[model samples]
Target: MSPYLKLLFYLSGISFAVSFEIDYSNPDVVEYDSNSQIEKTEKVDLRVYYCSFCGGCVYFHTKQLDPTLKKIGSYIDLKNYPYGLTTRYKKHGKIYFDCAHGPAECHGNKLHACAIDILKNTTQSEFYNSCMMNSTWGGEGSSDKDAINCGKLMRIDSKPIIECANSERGDAIMEYYGIETDKVTNPKNKHMPLILLNGKEFNRAKDLMKTICQTLTKPPPECKSYF
Candidate 1:
């Protein structure tokens, strides 16, 4: 991995560790005498692979996943990757492609990637939610202005994000997402909003909340109904 990617991983790990407080007093916790062996259950990482221009992906995220995510909060670590669905075209020895949502969607993807890099955790979510909610998916036109306006509303400096979107670094990040997306085993997994729980592919988008609750080693109070 590149140094930048390494940094992103390191920062994400730190964020996950610091975001939640573990409860050792849970009733399920086994009290161990000095001679008794103890078992460890690691926290699950929930990664979302999505495309900026996919209408279903956008709707699912904003309407379904976001609310549950907020409810679950620190119970799981969340990672969002923006993958483009267009195939690259070679012309005059240069490679280019038009996104399903148009060039504006490509720009929006770059902007989202840059926001994640520039901000951490909740701030990243703030920008992402704003952009997704205001984006022009399933409709006409681009979401460039909406994304920019959202950044401004969040008090983030939009200049760096804009510059990153146009830089080689942004291209590298997008390529990384593409490489990751291609590794999925499912033939129909080329579509957006591919969700993974604990590094395992998770289908059944409608049962997302239940699936997440089931996977938790020590689910929070909000997950009681699902249990």
Candidate 2:
């Protein structure tokens, strides 16, 4: 078992059956407009709370994370919450969202939500997400087609994602993400990409692999270089 996983098992004193249910209306998520920024595991349980249109998120994924995937990816289990600094309110049996980046960003968030839920696999969805997000770095606007195109590139069926994105289900999913993020203390994550490792906020500006190694209760061989 991975050391991180062992730590998880030790701390919980139970099986590692973590749930991914989307939980509420609002969270203390930082929103990036031209805007903000923000990774994985099969071993380290990692969660990223981010928004689709955040430039910081895009740059982090495209520049920092993409190249690092091969080094430390095997030891991680990753998940993404695509709603950031977004709020929702229910009225007359319907939920409405107000996103910082406008309607297009809301749409982008829905696409990501649908992809993560519909694909049903964290790695696959992350790849799909990475592709779509990386596109924006090249000055691509109108993110829908690019995101969908990324899905297709992975040979993932985009139909379900598209359907979910345009429907109420997508909104509900976004709402749930908002709820999950709400559990995080507001104002703590003052910048884009609020990352949690082992359910605690991860604060660091070091190399990704090294940071994980340092955080582990028992460092693995792969982490030797950092030490």
What CA root-mean-square deviation does each model show from the true structure?
12.4, 14.5
Off by over 4 Å in 1: 1-42, 89-95, 126-130, 136-142
lDDT of 1 by residue, 18-128 (tens): 122222112121122112224333346777777676766666665556546555644556677776475455578544656777787777677677766766554244335
RMSD of 1: 12.4
- The numbered model that scores best in lDDT is 2
Superposed by TM-score, candidate 1 places the C-alpha of residue 44 at a distance from the truth, in angstroms, of 2.2
Per residue, candidate 2 scores C-alpha lDDT tens digits across 29-119 of 1011111122122366677888887877765554445434444555565678888888788899999888888888888888889988987
User: Best candidate, TM-score-wise?
Assistant: 2
Candidate 2 wrong stretches, greater than 4 Å: 1-42, 136-142, 217-221
TM-score of 2: 0.73
Worst 10 residues of 2 by lDDT: 21-30
Give the range of the ten consecutive residues with the poorest summed lDDT in model 1. 27-36
> Cα miss at 39, model 1 (Å)?
18
